[model samples]
Target chain A: MNPAVWLIGAGPGDPELLTMKAVKALGLADVVLVDDLVDPRILDYCPDARIVRVGKRGGCRSTPQDFIQRLMLRYARQGLRVARLKGGDPCIFGRGGEEAQWLSAHGVACEVVNGITAGLAAATAVGIPLTQRGLATGVTLVTAHTQDGGMPDWSALARGGTTLVVYMGVAKLQDMRGQLLAAGMDAATPVAMIENASLPGQRECASTVAAMADDADAFRLRSPAVLVIGQVAACRMYGAPDAPALAETRLRRSA
Target chain B: MNPAVWLIGAGPGDPELLTMKAVKALGLADVVLVDDLVDPRILDYCPDARIVRVGKRGGCRSTPQDFIQRLMLRYARQGLRVARLKGGDPCIFGRGGEEAQWLSAHGVACEVVNGITAGLAAATAVGIPLTQRGLATGVTLVTAHTQDGGMPDWSALARGGTTLVVYMGVAKLQDMRGQLLAAGMDAATPVAMIENASLPGQRECASTVAAMADDADAFRLRSPAVLVIGQVAACRMYGAPDAPALAETRLRRSA
Candidate 1:
């Protein structure tokens, strides 16, 4: 039997970032349960399918986890092709693993289609390589907010020697900056705050880890933004409309 | 003027994993530069365009970076649309940032399109989430080998609360296992070694941080493989043909 449900990552913000595999899944979908963060434009790929908004955005009143799972199960049980669409890669803090396991336990077949994650897209949109050689050995993608309301191990991350990309960090700039400082991260370490990454309305604020909170406040950074922290964060390969202080930062990009 | 050069990611090994943006770029290309690791089937999108093979696989005598850059520059100088396709995200250890910066310095406009990175695809292919809530707060993507011949800070990574995904690690499983063990990572921490991720030939061998090297040896794991190290690495949401030891490991996948 064919897979009844597909958990697809709609990609960051840009609809074009969606994978061809994801588009194929959407085309076959009888109903699509989309997250709030997914661009509405992506739904155009599956215009004939029914669309359901089951947003679970932080600090917002939204659908409960169990209800969403049951809804997908109910739709799949009826032999309908169901698509659970989430922003960014479905498994990256999107509860895709949980949902997939639940469906599989119920004897339903499901497949996950990966997408361009927000952390990676946020850095790339502004010409910052997430793992730029010599500057960073690798990249770490974490979120400032967790389900338990606690924070990630800032001390370990500060010493990890990889570019740190923090999702959902707009509201915790000050707290994050302070924690990183206490963790002994360099005060002059560069940070790039990118909002609405990969979208036409994308905006980037350049600052140092020590000055990030202040710079973000001045730039009026908002939610749905990612913070890139490392030497590579200072690099901008080419000037883009979203970058306001491109001239100053371009000097930092190394070969 | 349109971008003269487009550095596109072909995703893991799946041709369908190519993004719409990458496909659009391919469609507009006058010449296409392909990498060795990239699936040739992706060239279907740019069938009418001139195709140049510029493979740069590790441990192989492949195209030189400088020569590839100059070739792209020469093509772009002629005002041609050049698509440089690499496996996975261009900016992630693909020298995309370096190439883009070089091209931009020479007055050529280049764009880097994000892709579903191989590390993420490998984990998801076997129903494993790189970042499962409670099990892992986040995920770190790093390469086992480095240009400078130095290793990443394993101690800090071991202490960091995230799932670790290591690319180009097939040959160094023994060394990596020792390093992680030396860095205080739990000996029994689950490990999933995935080969040819997201492709039809995908294969998985499940073991632990301590026994990975031995298990991989027994499984005859080859290059183009990725190693997932963490508690979340044990979780397999749904069984697939790639996972030969699914029965034993399924019991360990925590909800």
Candidate 2:
């Protein structure tokens, strides 16, 4: 609250998902630098704070990272409490580490408040237990889009026996599918493409490792969507017609 | 507010870390079934609700999962709002999926409100970004303890080029170290064992994959601790006297 930068995750889309700590930080904020992906409703908590939208959409002409950092620094130097609101958990591909390190080096104190990450929220919204027993031993969250525009180690991921959740992967379905298949991943492994995760407009398209690209094309999957690639994607616990209970699904699969 | 079961995550032992949705659910609860790992302070929000302590710690005399499910069903059947508070996010190794499925199968409506998982919170508490550019492409959250008492696919996890966050791993440090070593993970890969993540008394012991067991022994790492294993674990952005800025660290590593 004392003229420092608070790097807060606004959680995935839904305002209700915001943590009490994040809300408290927003309340103390004198100037807020928020990302485009963050819900504006969350700003209601910081009604008195000066709001600055630092939109940095992937593949879009948006605010540069350096400029955003300088803005936060300027506000902090002016003895104003600055809140940098990001979508999802700030440390999870949100450039929180970079910003925190930069702020520290520039002599601005920074505190990171964790939020519900998009990948986890998207999976749960669709009733996919990422680390369900008998299906996945663990869950791996990776971004397909990188600064170098390269790909993750698909072969190792395919072999990991963990549910793979890919961020910024909707556009690269074909390439990912090809790589996973080539890495000997089962074609029948389930895949779930979730759009606008945790938002009211959230949509899910279920497919398989072999058919996701085509299924996504048919489903009109968009950017900002998350892809859940694993057997658990087929295990829906929510209201889906004919969708077996997770326990039953695991029992059947194991049997 | 409806007469249904709400599986809420208590968010890594911090009461303030609770989501607004989880808080709302707790407010409307007529009965709250709480886990042992959940901090007692969170019950402050549901002071009016009947609190049922269902301790289910591993290797301890605890409540049975079946009995817990039945308790939730009983409360819901009586037209009472039931809140089942689990530590961390319900779906992330907290059995939220299994519980939701059980409630749904019993014709009881259930909802899951996501909370900040312990692994992510633990990483951030120590300024270890789970996924920093050039250091880790993504992160894997896995539990070393399982219902079947079997091990995860360590060889594949070792091959996967993502940071590894292990829950319930304090007890199996040596076994995991051996498997990861056999699987070809670098012995010097940095490891940070975080205890009581996100809490005021949170403690972190930094060591290498080869030396974690000994370090944890020296640090007396306890149960309910999370282990972060990766190159990024060696990278601290806050308060370390010689910790380099994340950008510089990444540049140096890539160079």
Candidate with top DockQ is: 1
- What ranges in model 2 sit over 4 Å off? A1-3, A239-255, B1-3, B239-255
Best by TM-score: 1
Looking at model 1 chain A, report the run of 10 residues with the lowest lDDT sum.
Answer: A246-255
Candidate 1 C-alpha lDDT tens digits along B25-44: 99999999999999978999
Cα lDDT tens digits, model 1, A1-255, are 458999999999799999999999999999999999999999999999999999988889999989999999999999899999999999988888999889888988888889899999988887898788889989999999776889999999999889999998888988998899999999899888888888877888888888888888878888889999999998876644443324323222111
- Superposed on the true interface residues, model 1 gives a C-alpha RMSD in angstroms of 1.5
Model 2 alpha-carbon miss at residue A237, Å: 1.5
lDDT of 2 at A190: 84
lDDT of 2: 0.86
Candidates' lDDT values, in order? Answer: 0.87, 0.86
lDDT of 2 by residue, A28-109 (tens): 9999998989998999999999999999997899999999999999999999999999999999999999998899889888
Per-model root-mean-square deviation over C-alphas = 3.4, 4.8
* TM-scores of all predicted structures: 0.94, 0.94
Question: How close to the true structure is residue A141 of candidate 2, measured as C-alpha lDDT?
Answer: 96
